[model samples]
Target: MSLLINIQYMPYVLAAIVVILITFRLWKWKRSLNYWRDRNVSGPTPVLYFGNTLTALFKPFVYTEMEWYKKYGRIYGVYGLVRPALTVAEPALVKQILVKEFHKFRNRMPETD
Candidate 1:
């Protein structure tokens, strides 16, 4: 019967689905790792998947930035989880980016109550 045939192939179908999901996850991880590279920016080396999670969990962002500032200088990029963030320590450049060009860079997060 058709039902018996499907039952026999069910395990193979499930395995194929699992393989596709794993491939998608690896693709996303690779894309995230390449974000700063595409922008020609560099920061501290990231741990696979976590991406600066150790310092983010232990130290305040400002403290972490301070340490990275000393190491990588004023302009560098960091990964907060899988997302890339640029940290600009220079006051003038920060003002220009955040204030002067505020309209150009819109918020990505949805507004919440």
Candidate 2:
């Protein structure tokens, strides 16, 4: 009967919806991550939904900065959400990027406006 068809497909329909939502979320996360990767020097693989860090939100680990340097060298990127942070080598590069010409990269983030 028609009832049998609907009942049999109910689980499949729910599974499909869940799959779609998970896929969408992953796609968005990757897109945001890639924006930094393209500009970054390079680094290790990012954890799924966890990112390149194991640190909690808004909390900087005592040796987190050193960890990045030790693992990825003085040049690499750490991503959390939309942040595209770069850990640069060469103090001159830092001066050039941060102080000498701060205006060129004023905001730590990009805005849609």
Candidate 3:
């Protein structure tokens, strides 16, 4: 009898769990969308899950990048599947990051035999 009651409540528990998971995912997506905006970076808007990936699907990657460069200027942010990425078009900034900031961006790989 106790087992029968547990089985009857199982579906409700499963449904509640699913609803919670969906809500969390949507909240995370919304938060991720605001990442660059919070930092005052400007760029194209992204869709819920696809981000700017769908743009690249229909257009050549290089042309898409060029369009963004022209529209957003020397610095912009883009989303690669909900992950925000910064693009620096200015040569001087790139040089600064590569040379002056090399320590901050050093590769972190574990040594192995």
Kindly list the per-residue Cα lDDT of model 2 for residues 2-57, writing each as its tens digit. 99999999999999999999999888887777765677567755666667665644
Steric clash pairs (candidate 3)? none
Between candidates 2 and 3, the one scoring higher on TM-score is 3
Q: Cα RMSD for candidate 3?
A: 4.6
lDDT of 3 by residue, 1-113 (tens): 99999999999999999999999999999899889999999999999888889999998989999999999999999998898888889999989977999798665333356
Give the per-residue lDDT of model 1 (tens digit) for 1-113: 99999999999999999999999998898788778878888788776688887787887877888889999888998876777777788999978877899887686344346
Please report, as a residue range, the 10-residue window in candidate 1 with the lowest summed lDDT: 104-113
List where candidate 3 sits over 4 angstroms from the true fold. Answer: 105-113
Name the candidate, 1 or 3, with the larger lDDT value. 3
| Per-residue lDDT of 34 in model 2 | 78
Tell me how far the alpha carbon of residue 50 in candidate 1 is from the true structure, in angstroms, after superposition. Answer: 1.1
lDDT per model vs. reference = 0.82, 0.72, 0.90
* TM-score list, all predictions: 0.82, 0.59, 0.86
Question: Which stretches of candidate 2 lie above 4 Å from their native place?
Answer: 1-18, 55-60, 109-113
Best by TM-score: 3
Q: Name the 10 consecutive residues with the lowest summed lDDT in model 2.
A: 53-62
Each prediction's total of clashing residue pairs, residues at least 3 apart in sequence or on different chains, is 0, 0, 0
